[model samples]
Target: MSSLDAEPHAPGADAPRSPGPLLAIESSCDETAAAVIAADRSVLSSVVSSQAALHERFGGVVPEIASRAHVERILPVIREALAEANVTPTDLSAIAVVTHPGLVGSLLVGVTAAKTLAAVWDLPLIAVDHLRAHLYACRIAYGEEAFPACGLVVSGGHTNWYDCPDAVRATLIGSTIDDAAGEAFDKVARLLGLPYPGGPSVQQAAEHGDPTAVPLPRPMMNRPELAVSFSGLKTAVRYAALGNPNSPEVPAPPLGERRIADLAASFQAAAVDVLVGKCDLALKQTGRPTLLVGGGVAANRALRVGLTDLCERRGVRLCIAPMELCVDNAAMAGLAWESFERGEFAPLDCDVTPGLVRA
Candidate 1:
C-alpha cells in the first residue's frame, strides 16, 4: 500500500490524522540540500551545504569534487533537516530525491542515501526532476495560483522553457543550443577577472557602469524558433575583452574598473534581453497568462526588473521564486508532493537519469 493510503485508523474515524512530513534531498550539483515539507506545502526546514568555496578556484564545479562533497554532506544535511523540523524517519510519509540531469556521481550520492533511508524506514520513494524542481519553486512560493504558466529554468547547467499546465505536468517547449545563461555569466566574469559564480559579481559591477557603453551581440534574438544561443555572445565578449586571438598580440590596453563595469552591464543587459524576449515568445506560443522564472539566474536583480517590466507591459502575471528558492535546494523539491499525492512512488531499484528531460 502507498504511504498516502497507509493510515491506520478505521474508516470514518472520529479524529482525523495529520499528514506526516516528507523528506526531500537534492544533490544534483554542487549543493547538498535536504528539506522537510508537509503535505500542506509547509516547508518545515531547508538546509543546503554549498560547495562554492571548493569549486571557486576552478572557476566552475568539478564533477568528482562535487560528488565527493555530496557524499560527505548528504547524511549530515538530511539529519539536520529532520531535526530542525522535529521529525524523525518514522515521522516521514515519504522520501523524495532528485535523480536526473546532473553529474552522475553527485546524483548517486543522494539517490543512494535516499534509497537507504527508504529501505531502512520502509518509506515511499519519489523521484523528482531537477529542472522541474527549479520551475516548481514558483509553485511552492505562490501555491496553487501560480500554474498554467510559462516556466523558464535559467541556470549554470540549464536554460529551458516549459509549458506548465499545472503543478504536476510540464511540457518542454524550448531550450538553449549552446551555453546556459548562468554559464555565460561565469565565463564573462572570468574574462573580466571577477570572482567565480559570476552572476552576482557581474550584477554588482554593472550597477556603476553604463549598460549601453559596450555593444555585445544578442544571439538568437530574431531567430525563428524559441531557442536561445549564448555561445556566440560569449565569443563576442571574449573578442571584445582580449582582442582577436587569431591575430598577433597587439598590446591591448588594460581593462580598468569603468571598462569592466560597462562590459558587465552590457553583457547582463544583452543576456536579460534574450531571456525576456524568449519568455515573450513562450508566453505567446503557450498563451500562458503567467510567467514563472526560476533557477540560479533568477536571482539576478536586473533580470528580475526586466521580467517585471515585460510582464507588466504584456499583461502577464509574473512569479519569481524568492532568492532562497532560486538556487538549487531541497525545499523546492517539495515538488515531490505532487507525485506523492498521485501515489507515484518509485521502486528501490529505480536508478538515476544523469541528463533527463522531457521532449
Candidate 2:
C-alpha cells in the first residue's frame, strides 16, 4: 500500500501531515553523521561515525581518509537511522546536507548522497551551512526558547560571533583574525605533551595544572573591534613551555598539583574571559536578550560555566546545546525543516565550497 493510504486520513483534509520528516547528513569533517527528524524539532534517529582513529596519528583529520569513511558509512548510517526511526524514504519529505566550509572531499560525500536521494526520490534538496548547523543545535536543545539571539560558534577550525535572525539566516558579526579557539586548545595541549584532540586533554590537564603558574597574555582583550587573535595566546603557551623565545625546547617544569590546577584554571580563565567579553559586546550591540553558543568548543565545561555566569550577571538569557549536540552531528541538521517550508533549494550546479564564509 502507498504510504498515504497506509495511514488513515480525514476526508477532504489533505493527508495527515506529520511533522515534516527530514533526513539530514553531515560530513563536513571527520565525523560521518545522519539523522531523521520531524518538523517539530523532534529527533527520530541520530547516528555519527567518527574518524578519530583514522587520523589520530596524523595530528588532525586527513581529508582523503575522512571522505572514504563517509562513503563507506553513509549508506549504513542512513539505513540505521531509518530503521531506528521506523521510517522509510517514501515517508521523508526532503533531504538536507552540509555542503560547504569543510574539507572538500568530506563535504562531497554528504552532498553527493543528498543529491542522489533528492533525484531518486524526487525529494526537495536543502543545503545547510555547516556553521549554521552548529547554531541550530541550540534550537534542537531548547525547543521553547526564543530565537534571533546572538551565537558564538567555537570549534577546532572556527571561532566566530553571529547575529542569528533565525535558523536559516545568520549574519557574521565577528571572527578570528588568526587561529580558532579549538585550534589553540589543541596546540597548547600538544605543547603540554597532552594527548591528541587537544580540547579535552587540555581541559583535563588544566584541571591539575596551574593556569596562574605562568602568566599568559589574553589576545585582543582590549581591542575595540570584534576580531580575535589566538595566535598570540598560542605563542604564549609555547613560550611557557620552552621558556625564552630563542631558547631550545625544554619540558615544562613541574608545578605542585594545585599549581597545575591553577594553570589549567588560568588558561581556561584567559580563553573564557576573551570569549565572554566578545559575546557580551555582541549582545549589547544587538540588544538581544538571548545568547546561544554552539560548536565543539561549546562542550568545554569551563566555557559553559563562564558564559553562563557572564550572561546571568548581564540579565541575558543563554542557551547552549547539550554536549551530545554541541559537537559535529546530523541531528542539528534538522534545521532543514525551515528551508523545506520556505521552498529553498539549491541548483545542481552547486559545488563544494571548502572555505565558505558566513561573515
Candidate 3:
C-alpha cells in the first residue's frame, strides 16, 4: 500500500493530507545516525553508531578515523533504522541528510550515501544544515510551540546563537570567537587526564568539587557584543593544571582527585556563566520570548541548570532538547520535513558545506 493510504485519520472522518515517513541520515561528525520519522513528529526508529572509543586514545576526534568509521557504519545504521521502523525505501516520502559545517570527509560519506539512495529510490532529496539540525532537536522535543525564540547551539565543533523565527529559518545572532564550549571542555579534560568526550567527564568530576574552589576567568563577559570566547578560559585551566609551560622542567605534582574535581568545577562554572550571560543578552536583544538550546553541550547538567534559572528569571519559555536528541543524531534531522512541506528539495548536484557561516 502507498504511504498516503497508511496515514492516520480522524475518527469517523476522512484523513487530511499529511507528509509520509522521511528517512534522515546524519554523519556530520563522528556519529553515524539514521531515523524514520512520520509527518506528525512521531519517530518510528532512530539509530546512532558512535566512534568515541576509536578516537579515545587520541584525546579528540581524529578526522580520518571518524570519516572512515562513518563510511563503514552508515549503510548498516540506515538499514537498521529502516528495519526497526518497519519501512522500506519505497515507503519513504523523502530522504534527508545533513550536508554542511562538519568534517568534510565525514560529511561526504553521509551525503554520498544519501545521494545514491535518492537516485536509486527516486526519492526527493532534502539538504539540512548540521547546526540547524541541532536546534531542530528542540522543535522535535517540544513541537511547533518551540519557535520564535533564540536558539543556542553548543557542541564540540560549534557554538552559535540564532534568532529562530520558525523551524527552517534561523538568523545568526552570535557565536564563539574562539574554541567552542564543548571543545574547551575536551581540551581541559585532556589537561586533567580525563577521557575523550569531555563534557560528561568534566560534569561528573565537578559534581564532587566546589565550583568556587578555584577562580577561572569568564572570557568576553564584559564585551558589548554577544560573542563568547573560551580560548583564554581554556588556557587558564591549563596553567592551573600544569603551571607555566616555560618553567616546567621539574616534574609537576600529580593532580589529586580533589584538585582535579575543583579545577573541573571552577572551569565548568566559568563556562556556564559566559554561556548564560550571552543567552540572556541574546534574548534581550532579539526580544524573543522563548529560548531553545541544543547540541551536545546542552546535555551538561550545569548548562541546563544555568539556562533554566536564566529563563525563569526573565520569564522566557525555555525548551531544551532531551539528552538523547541533544547529541548529534538523525532524529533531529527529521526537521527536513519542514523544508519538504515548503517544496525546498535540493537538486542532485548539491554539495556539502564545511563552514559554520553559510551564505
Q: Is candidate 1 or candidate 2 better by lDDT?
A: 1
Rank all candidate structures by their TM-score, best first, as comma-separated numbers.
1, 3, 2
TM-score of each: 0.94, 0.91, 0.93
For model 3, give the 10-residue run with minimal summed lDDT: 2-11
RMSD of each: 4.0, 3.9, 4.6
lDDT tens digits by residue: candidate 2, 79-182? 88878888877778788899878999999989988887777666678888889888889898887464879988899899989997767778999999998999
Among these predicted structures, which one has the highest TM-score? Answer: 1
Q: How does each model score on lDDT? A: 0.89, 0.81, 0.89
Write candidate 3's Cα lDDT for 111-212 as tens digits.
Answer: 999898887777789999988888888888898999888999999998999998888889998999889999999999999988988999999999999999
Worst 10 residues of 2 by lDDT: 2-11
Clashes of 3: 0
Question: Could you give me the TM-score of model 3 versus the true structure?
Answer: 0.93
- Native-vs-model 2 lDDT? 0.81
lDDT of 1 at 8: 33
User: Alpha-carbon error at 180 in model 1, in Å?
Assistant: 0.6
